[model samples]
Target: MRATVIHAPGDIRVEDAPEPKIVNPTDAIIRTVATCVCGSDLWPYRGLEPVGDPHPMGHEYVGIVEEVGSEVSNVKPGQFVVGSFATSDNTCANCRKGWQSSCLNREFMSTCQAEYVRIPNAHGTLVATDEHPSDELVPSLLAVSDVMGTGWYAALAAEVKPGSTAVVVGDGAVGLCGVIAAKELGAERIIAMSRHESRQKLALEFGATDIVSERGEDGIARIKDLTGGIGADSVLECVGTSQSMSQALHSARPGGNVGFVGVPHEVAVDGQELFFSQVGLRGGPAPVRRYLPDLIDRVLSGHINPGKVFDLTLPLEQVAEGYKAMDERRAIKTLLTP
Candidate 1:
């Protein structure tokens, strides 16, 4: 099988690698049908995160089940499935509380940008569709596996409510999906903070009522001005940078909330500032398994089309170019077909 390997920062290559096998009784191997480059993958690609020895890349995937271990009974061979980046047993205490991402037996997927992937905790992590979906729904189904799910979690964490004002502090794929989530959750006013024309347009199409193209203190001020000087009722901090985090914190009114989903990079909160601001904060890896069933249904029903975030598509063999396009901001997200 061919897989994406990062030999070093700014270096991505597609090379032959051994196919994965069931290392545990709960494991299942799936022949990847669709996968994509995630914003998080850029961390190591841009040298923001260290890339030690070369290793396979990617985590978001939708595939056809090729085989399952003896203990796996939730799915069978030949079924189409979508799974989260964080695999969980789903039977654990955390999972029972709706936090599958923090399950006792959890494994983070890191080799999905290939022809085949071994899914851990198959019984609890993989959600199979009733039947094989049409080719047109594949991209949206693949989006439900990660980006859309993460965006939903961001909205939930921020406590987006009916007729409330919500702010999204990023223009990436996840943030765009956050706008969709906020709209579906009944946010009457959705403010998307973006500087890119393409992203701003997409955000509007996804239900953004306003766009704030400023940054730093200016962005927060714009959010306040739009919210009648009280700031928004909820803020989704989709970017993990310190500046973005601060913007999210300041963009929310007192007693409001901020849901931060970005993998925090050099981000920290000032204790005094947070205490005085009285804003609630919650974030981490999304429990995508908990929302997979509904998100998949939404895709199949044509209720939400988060797949539109993928502005570029490439064959799995051209994975390097996918990474380059996303890194250069030429594409919001890249869809990779195997």
Candidate 2:
């Protein structure tokens, strides 16, 4: 099978690779139908994160079950399924507490930008649709696998409440989905911080009531000005940069919360500042498995179209261009079909 491999920073290639097999009884092998380039993937691509030896890339995927291990029962061959970037055994203590992303038996997916993928903890991680969805719903279903799920977790972590003011600090795919999540969760006023015209338009279409194009202290001031000098009730930190994190932390009102979902890169928080600000912070990998069933339903029901975040689509073999487009900010996200 063909898969994406990163030989080094600024170097992405599609090469032939061995197909994955079930290494554990709880594993299942699926033929990937749709996958995509995630914002996190750019970390190593841009040299922000080290790329040691060459390895397969990608994680977000929606696929058709090709085979199942003996222990796998929830999904079987011929079924369409969506799984999280972080696979979990869902039966673990953390999973029982709704934190599947931190399950005792967890595996992070890293080779999904291929024709096939081996799913760990299949019974607990893969959510099967009732029937095969139409072609049009595939992109949205694929989005539910990661970006949308992450965005939803961001909103939940920030404690977005009905009629409350919410701020999203990012314009990427996940941040755009965060806007959708905030709206669905009843945030009456959604402020999306973006400088890109396309992303700002999408954010508005996704239910952003205001747009703040400023950065640094100016952005925080704009948030405060819009919130009547109190800041927002909740802030979603979708970009993992030091500046974005600080913006999110300062954009929230005292006693409010900031849900940070971006994979932190050189980000540090001042404990003294946090203490004085009295803002809550909660974040990490999203428990996408916990929200998969509902998100899948929402996609099928046409309630949300997070798939719109994918402004570019390419064949699986053109994966390198997908990475390039996203890295250059020419595309918000790239959809890859195998």
Candidate 3:
């Protein structure tokens, strides 16, 4: 099997790798049908996140189950399934509470950008569709694995409500998906902060009612101006930078809420600013498993096209180009077919 290995920042290669097999009764091995590069992957690729050793790269995946372990009964071979970025045992207390990302037996699903990958907690992490999905539905279903799910979490954490003015910071795939999420949540007005023409257009299509191309304080003022100086009722911070974080905090109305979903890098918030701002903050890795069922239904029903975020697609062998396209801002997200 061939898989992507990150040797160092800006150094990635596709090379022969060992095949994966079920090592535990709770595990399953799946042949990759589709996978993609994530925004978070760039953290290690850009050298911002430490990478002391070469390792497998990628997490988001959708594939057909080739085999399951002795204990995996809910999902069997030949079923098409979507998986969360993290694994979890469904029986855990946190899993019961809808935080499968923080399950007691949780494990990160790395080494999936390959021809074959092993899945732990198979029954808990994999969501099989009602039937095999068509080729057209693969991309959308794949989105459920991470970006779409994370965007939905951002909206949920921000407390978006009917008739609420919601502001989204960032124009990446997740931010655009946030626009879709805010719309689905019944937000009356969706403001997307984006300067890129392509992303701004997608934001509008995803239900954004306004676009703010400013940054920092200027962006905050624009959000306030759009909301009649009271700021938005809810703000979704999709970029984990310090500037974007501050923008999200300041874009919310006093007593409003801000949900940040970006993989934070060098982010430090001022205690005084948060204290006086009176804005609630909540976010972490998205519990994608909790929302997978509903999101899968939406995609299967053709009610949403969140997969449009993938402006580029490549063969699994060209995974390096997929990463470059996303890092260079040439593509919003890149999808890979094995």
The model with the greatest lDDT is 1
Residue pairs in collision within model 3: none
| lDDT by residue for model 2 (117-182), tens | 999999999999999999889999999999999999999999999999999999999999999999
Give the RMSD in angstroms, all C-alphas superposed, for model 1: 0.5
Give the lDDT of residue 212 in candidate 2. 97
Which runs in model 1 stand beyond 4 Å of their true positions? none
Ten-residue region with minimum lDDT total, candidate 1:
216-225
Using Cα atoms with residue i matched to residue i, what is each candidate's TM-score against the true structure? 0.99, 0.99, 0.99
Instruction: Write down the TM-score for model 3.
Output: 0.99
lDDT of 2: 0.96
Provide the overall lDDT of each model, using Cα atoms, as 2-decimal numbers.
0.96, 0.96, 0.93
Write model 1 residue lDDT over 1-338, tens digit each, in one string.
Answer: 99999999989999999999999999999999999999999999999899999999999999999999999999999999999999999999999999999999999999999999999999999999999999889989999999999999999999999999999999999999999999999999999999999999999999999999999989988999999898999999998999899999999999999999998999879999999999999999999999999999999999999999999999999999999999999999999998
Kindly provide the TM-score of model 2 when superposed on the true structure, using C-alpha atoms: 0.99
Reference-based lDDT, residue 53, model 2: 100
lDDT of 1 at 179: 99
- lDDT score at residue 40, model 2, on the 0-100 scale: 95
Q: Candidate order by lDDT, highest to lowest?
A: 1, 2, 3
What is the Cα-based TM-score of model 1? 0.99
